[model samples]
Target: MTADSSLLAQAREWHVLLHSGRATAADRAAASAWRCTSPAHEQAAMDVERLWALLGQLGEQPASEPAAAQVRPLRRRRSLRWAVPLASAALLVLALWLPQGAWMSWNADFATAPGEIRSVELEDGSILTLNGATALDWTISEGRREIRLYRGEADFQVAKDSTRPFFVEAGPARIRVTGTRFDVDYDGQDVVLAVTQGQVQASDAQAQPLLVGASQQVRWSGERLQPLQALDARQQLAWQRGKLVFRAQPLSEVFTELERSQRQRVIFLDQSVRDLKVTGVFAHDDPQAVLRAIESNLPVRLVRLPGLLLVSRS
Candidate 1:
């Protein structure tokens, strides 16, 4: 039986809250009562738990191998281990998974794991390049072609078909184009569109269609589209070439990208350090090198932990 979307959302929210360190006993009691409301609610909660279990096993080795042989050596020489509690680890996983629509990722036609960049050739001769941790679903019919980007970023080199238009639904914005090359980045809260070739029409839930041409980009958040800004489209899309170009961006923004490409969680202990300006072109393949450079140039220190990295002000 299919669970209602609203019920699934509620179940996911409750799961995250229960796992979060901030949840109180009262919250747990309330969540239990919520699950008792209906059989659908209970099933939704079970589904959420099942998904969490699957996520936990993503890093595990095959069961055919002996457990003793599965252990691996630590990458860092520093013996400093942050005493992260079991609850905190669960919370961290949920924090990283939920925002990317874990449900959608599970059902996506195409998905790339963290730190994996993949290219797919469509039946229509279009080429799709998916960035790390991205998930998307697509359908190409005789009348039209539609792509729903649930999370992360993708570059599309659409094949020319004058009789059919390509439509991409990303967060609050929808893009319609015909035989164009463009990039779309959607991180749950915001949607960014950059056109590298030809022109595309982008619109949000409440905004009119905005024409974005080559070298132009626009951002959509809270159902509103920001003004078009001109940029070096090639520079913005350097990730396809194994490079990341940052120009005076916030340290938090830089780490977000690193988290995708490195498959590691980075937590900022001090909020003030997140706003530090960072500018440089770094190789995407060497996330540790980039972190070392940031540590050297910025007034910050790094603490390596198992599956996580902590940053704080010096």
Candidate 2:
């Protein structure tokens, strides 16, 4: 039987926590109780265990070696009372080393690692600046310059070519421009376009084309495009200079951007804190400092884990 996506995710989380080498007796008990809540939950957990066994057998090193290395520093006390099987911990190690965008990185002609920004000059003289964890493929034919942004954000400085139009396909949004400077941020769910110079035509499958000029921005989602809104292009595109600027955004959204620069996952233990508003100008180079600043200003505390950070109410 196919397991529900939400239940599968929960099962994965439980497996990670149990094998993290920090699982307490209480944690194991809680997991057992969770499994007993529903038969579907138990089946999901069993599926995860089977997946772990396959990964362990296919892994190059012993199943426990990687997990031991990762959690050694965090292991202040031994949890001898609750022992996890070697195969069960293999998935935790894999999760630590591989990101969700691994497939995108493999398929992209140009891709940037976490916390890495890259600039490439096309043969057509256009400049493309990729943000951290970004991936895209480009095709420059005699008649057109096309870019497929698989994930993340990018800034484009299109070279004027009257005979060849520039096109960017990101998720459900389609952008067209002949010669212009613009930034496109695709986070899988939404595509946001910001024009710094010249004009850009933004559209989706079911919406009319919208013309966005310099200092304007538009968002495309769910087969619809939002009306253009005025923005300071310079401030919005400060990420090119290793800076991040946010204006009254939610804490969860801020953390999403921070993850691109920090190369770490952020988990909110208290859901209420996700909606807290955040506004600041932070240097992307020092994500820890940025997190500290947020903690000082907001009513939240940061907990560092093996490969992720947890946020909780102060």
RMSD of each: 16.2, 15.7
State the lDDT at 156 in candidate 2. Answer: 97
lDDT of 2 at 153: 95
lDDT of 2 by residue, 1-72 (tens): 535546767888999899999999999999999999999999878867765665565443432435546576
- Give candidate 2 regions above 4 Å deviation: 1-97
The per-model lDDT (C-alpha) reads: 0.80, 0.80
Which residue pairs in model 1 clash with each other? Answer: none
Error of 1 at 128 (Å): 0.3
What is the Cα-based TM-score of model 1?
0.68
lDDT of 2: 0.80
lDDT string for model 1 (116-170, tens) is 8999999988999999888999998888999999888999999989888999998
